[model samples]
Target: MLYLFGAIALFVIFDSVRGYLKTEDKRKYLVRLFLELTVVIGLLFLFGPLFVLSPLKIGYSTLKEGNITLYYPGGSIDMARDVMEQLKQAAEMNRQFYKANYPMPVVLAQSEFDMLRFGSYPYGGGTGSELSLNIRAGQMTTGKIAHEMSHRNLAMLTGKSMPAPNWFNEGLASYIGKMDEYKKPNELQVDLREGRYVRDILEMRGILGTPKWILKIRQGKGRVLYGQTYLMVKYLFDKYGQEKVYDFVVSLKTNDFEKAFWQSFGMSEEEFFQEFTSYIQNYRGEPS
Candidate 1:
């Protein structure tokens, strides 16, 4: 009905215009009216879907191949389905890896980035929410999908109650996304030796407080930070053991990072940071 109402209104306007134009020749007046109406109809057809002028429900837009449902005002159904399926698979894998039972439904939006940017967001992908992937970024890589899925799984495992620190959240996501493999130690070492580190993970912990900073890093220098965070999480798991890692994740859910860290590793944040930093420096060794 909204569309019907709009069509009716258009017709009324056109008829009023036709009446006012009192052309002496009936044939000429009819021809002019027909041309005007045709132009209006053509414009409506071109832009109607874009604006969702009609409140008609595009019921159950299902992508069977992807095994996902896409709720959108308008788009290519086939492409949306494909993206949804890939994201579902990625989310499932993350859920298994983290052992999160209550997996939240993923929401997809068409934006410049495939994944949702962090900050004060409410409805879809925002603070205190589970996984929300941007459809645009979904087209880029399955890795991006995995990264956001990690966020969702983490949120669910913790009952969406406890808030995780920046390092832990981004690090866990980057780790699950398998970004570490993309950053070989040899390459990183070479960069370090040449004093050309692209992004310092420790530095980003401070800089990533703002949305603009986060967006910049995610698009530009942030890739390097992701690699570093992945490495840090991996190192933590390898050094402290997966059981400890599991406990830390649990503590994160319970909002007891201090207790969790101390209980599992017998160290506070300062101690752990000092040790971990030393360990990284030692492993890398002085250049020359």
Candidate 2:
């Protein structure tokens, strides 16, 4: 589009110059040239950032460190190194817990939205494929790195085309990284007392299907949804154990939720949901 606009502008300018030199009336030609220039400038202003033509002096290097190769991209290299080290530790922890032999590389990018957008692509974060960790200068904490590494581990374990539901996936990631610990039950109780819990998941399920759901959840309304999901996954882990949950997650990699639920724990979805709801309502145990 920019190219076509540029060509048209050039032709208009050349014609206008010819009209100014050879014809009696150059005012109309000048007006046409000005309009063409305006259109060209508008196109450039609108499309310039979209093109990313700034050469993006981004550099990346792969280093084989222990069990994983860290793919580090430009922008705070020191922070990127720290994130990689943290991810390695987390990956090792997950490997020990799951006893899985497969280890894949971790690719750390420079943008959080870029990592999420990459994962948003069709099969972007697949098994034996790369997982992107967006590193911000002051924001890349150990907990955040662990959380992202957990995502990579889950992706590898699932080997599915699309990720599992955000509730399960994000809840588990949040749990692994200890982000859930920040949410005191009292805080949630306050929300519940204030009638802010949004009690029914069905009411907000449509928003869950949209891309903005993450932001919505981060904005606090997502709390009720994630809190419930966290409780549900914690219930599964508590009732069946982490190994069982791991088996269930691995099953989900190849099978649907219903099939995986039954195969992993010998219960149907309806039965599991019933038990899960019961556990959430009655389980008075401390948060894991």
Candidate 3:
């Protein structure tokens, strides 16, 4: 509807300009064009912040405590309070991991459509920025919030213009959130053995640049990519220690991620990938 309305507005402006160019009655055209423009502008103002107005339409209520602000549907105050608590806990966990604190906004969406209204991906949960999350209203959980909070914390710790590689970014989050234990080492070993996982680390750099990654998630093929990345990050933290990893992430604020990786880890990304890939391929454990 917004696109359609914008197209109509463009047509109106074009038609008005053409009429002004051709008109013998200049004063009449000027007056008519002014009115048309006024109407279009008025409608634009009315519709521009539709997402802001949606809360009122849905009888949503706001809750605030310290740095966390939550918007939830009316009659769900109890649930909203629970979400706020979860956010607080998630924030604390991230603060301990990152050694810093940041404020975040959370929206408890009654449905995926509600999540979309707030510019959040509606698949279970999503974040709009380093400091905002939209979660399916009733499905909020510790692991999910932790996952998103890790993303937010890392974003806060690093430069936005040049982000860390996709694999590192998501792998760190999944590792911190502890959400991929279900993926299982045996399953990853199968993917590795079958040549189904990411073959090159460069391919993992911007994996989310295409819609196919999300499609893979929906098709239940995400475990391979996510699981492999998680293990890779786990490998870094385990072998290099947390402080070194922290230094690398913090260096991103001043350096390109590749430069930071070299400075802190003492190796190129390819070197690390080769090391990690070999490690994971040889990792064997009883299936969980």
- Report the Cα lDDT for candidate 1: 0.54
Q: Tell me the lDDT of model 3 at 42.
A: 54
Query: Which clashing pairs does model 3 show?
Result: none
After superposition on all CA atoms, what RMSD does each candidate show versus the true structure? 13.1, 10.9, 5.6
Task: Report every candidate's CA lDDT.
Answer: 0.54, 0.55, 0.70
Give the clash count for model 3. 0
- Over the stretch 135-169, how does candidate 2's per-residue lDDT look in tens digits? 34344456555655666677667764234655566
Q: Give the least accurate 10-residue stretch of model 1, judged by summed lDDT.
A: 114-123
Error (Å) of candidate 2 at residue 4 is: 28
Cα lDDT for residue 115, candidate 3: 65
- Model 3 TM-score, all chains together: 0.77
Best by lDDT: 3
Model 2: number of backbone collisions: 0
Q: How many backbone clashes does candidate 1 have?
A: 2
